[model samples]
Target: MLAAKRMFSLAVADTDLFLEMPSSTQALYFHLGLRADDDGFVSSPKKIAKICGCGEDDLKILASKHFILPFESGVVVITHWLLNNNRIKSDRYKQTLYIAEKSMLEVENGVYMFTGSRMYPERNQNGDITEPQIRLDKSREEKNRVNNNGRKTSRFTPPTVEEVQEYCSERGNAVDAQSFVDFYISKDWYIGKNKMKDWKAAVRTWEKNQRQKNKKSKDDEGLEGWLNA
Candidate 1:
């Protein structure tokens, strides 16, 4: 079940942190909040921006100001989501499908804060929320355990095909998730004779390499046509 309405706090909207942004960015924030899931995740922020006659710069501003948090997959989460809608009944609350992204966040003082390798928001002496600060010395280790022989082991876990597809969809990339998994599986999840530490990073690397390869191919075709002409 889904809630019928969304809520906003003046504690957020009335502050300089919110008012200092461009009007389009503020409007986009409202529209995004209206369309976000019960957990405050907006999976199609770019599409929403397009529909609202807003530009990428509006989204970027909101993200930069800590009004929203952008994931590499193109999804955005409202930073003050919990503060805005804390009264919703649990029965009507539907969890977001972005579990991987959700897992990296933590609620602090009724606001959503990132727990991973990203900047987190805080307040200054004036009681106004300030820009994000780099959270240092945080470990993203999945798990550590001792084996039967008393040797500790920590292994990299590969993402599922569904997760890969979802991440790629959020990123608006055309990478074949199944093919990526199969190729890594064939190599026993090793990247150039070393164990792959992060699959998401590898995906970005693949996307980058693919784009360069595609550009080179087009340039080569252009050169061949010119030679023939």
Candidate 2:
């Protein structure tokens, strides 16, 4: 998750699966492999494709080679992941969140029975699936919490230089956007020990600090002028 060391086996590049693919596809394979957990599961292939500047077609290529498998839910599980990466059998290597995907892997033959249920699904009195009904006010609140993308809307994304500049201008503060961006970029946009929660809040804190420094400078200048007069 953090920028740590990762291993890439030479066998991957040597295999027909790697050599046959276009350079872009090869690179995508490595990226997915490196990011996958011990069980070789990567969430949201579509999102990964967008981030890696690849396409769905590339994912299909990997899937065809048995390098990866895509689930209907957009998760991609890397095949034979255990062969390359080593993990301790402790807490970190415990239960996986991709139990459904792992189960689907066993359907090499005709898919016999489909199992697993939706997360946070609405169920009726008889345990039948039904549309969830909520108060209009609560529905609006929930809608606001999730973005257009299925992501939980609360995660922080680093603001662009233009965004920082515009926000500082709107707040009437002379906070240096470049300085702010550079500082965070060096730290990989982390605030304290965690990923930044709110870039706007960080900007506000910078603005307040800048205002105090400017006020102090002006006071010093006024003191000099008074002494001269």
Candidate 3:
């Protein structure tokens, strides 16, 4: 699932890489920010390129500049993801695919300078440096597990824009998949009043609505010409 929000640090403007990079690279970075998980990892570059119109060259450029680190597993970890974003509460934070990729990253000479450090610093009872405690409030956990309607919270993963695009294309519909994604994303993946239980259902709904609207427009145009003739 995508993050509800992500920080774009102003510090990037001061970096040489940001200034020197081409517009295509800059656009790719921005799209990655939108699609990345809470851990700042983007899973599939090919899919991202298809959706965002940025090419693989952009990924190579970012990785070469140390702005991103690419893994053999096809994962790209944004170097400054932790630096730019505010820390999330441990319970709400989803585990990243990076756990398994970190070892491969290290072997590949990828930079992970913050490992075992205080990304989420916490003080001990004695006010001394200590390991960060993962404080999971039982009540909050239970609340998330069950919705207001008493249904179990959905395990539904939000589809990326590229995935939506493919689905729409398969049905020969001209639905604006990105716009659909943006709308739901803005609402924190909720429908009109509830959390979206199924995103594919939403996609199908959009496809049906768009197709019906198109057919009505064509029929209206034909009727108008026939009446005039």
Candidate 4:
């Protein structure tokens, strides 16, 4: 079943080196795509499906098993472990093939092309600026986006120093406090020259403010309720 061709045919078996291995769909993911080689993830289902010669529904159902992540626009990310380790169930793959022809609908041809140019999308692009034959350099602002009901939002709020420390500290947690602090700093919560001092001070200040607020809340809740009780 795993018969690779000299040239890509947009058929599922074409790119899959292990095509004959049980469920051919899993083998499809294993070979052609499924790597952190490029943008850290694959983003085109059409390309993946065409390479697999399967329908989109088949892909989605197979994907839902935690093997693939279908993101906004046409982003389809196959988890590293999914392709290398996990195996796809043949029954599910058969079920998917019986469904609608869900093309990734992104690739214009067997080759992935830029939106307005003949150039193919690749892992790297480096050339003299003057050599750019960009017919339409339609650009997008780079920001970590949050998907809200299928719409991308570009707003992000960073955690303050005190917030970070409190997260590291809890009410008598099992992990050692100092170890937790070290782990937190290692995670980039603390950085630069005067980081340790600044982080400690921030924690103290936040705790002081929190105590004052709680005290005030208690005072307000006391009088009327205290008398009634």
Please provide, for model 1 over 61-132, each residue's C-alpha lDDT reduced to its tens digit, 9 standing for 90 to 100.
776566887775678899888878545776776788999999978877677866633444567676666554
TM-scores for all candidates? Answer: 0.56, 0.42, 0.45, 0.25
Better of 3 and 4 by lDDT: 3
Q: Cα-based RMSD of the predictions, in order?
A: 11.0, 17.2, 16.9, 18.0
What's the lDDT for residue 96 in model 4?
21
lDDT (10s digit) by residue, model 2, range 1-229: 3224445544444554467778778878878877776666787766777799998667766664445655656677765455354343565454558887777543222211112211122444655323211112223323435667876764344555667888889988888886887677555577888878788899999888888999999999999999999
Clashing residue pairs, backbone N/CA/C < 3 A, model 4: 1-19, 1-20, 2-19, 2-20, 12-52, 12-53, 46-104, 56-102
Clashing residue pairs in all predictions, respectively, total: 2, 0, 0, 8
Can you give the lDDT of residue 121 in candidate 1?
Answer: 55
Candidate 1, superposed: residue stretches over 4 Å from native: 117-126, 132-134, 138-229
The TM-score-based order of candidates, best leading, equals 1, 3, 2, 4
Instruction: Give all candidates' CA lDDT scores.
Output: 0.78, 0.61, 0.64, 0.39
In candidate 3, what are the lDDT values of residues 1-229, reduced to their tens digit?
A: 5558777765553454476788888888877877777777789865887788888777766654446656546777776676565346787788776788654332112124222221222344544322222222335433445678898774554555666788888888788886887667555577888878778789889888888999999999999999999
How many times do residue backbones clash in model 1? 2
Q: How high a TM-score does candidate 2 get?
A: 0.42
Candidate 1: residue 54 Cα off by (Å)? 0.6
Candidate 1 vs 2: which has more lDDT: 1
Model 3 global lDDT (CA atoms, 0 to 1): 0.64
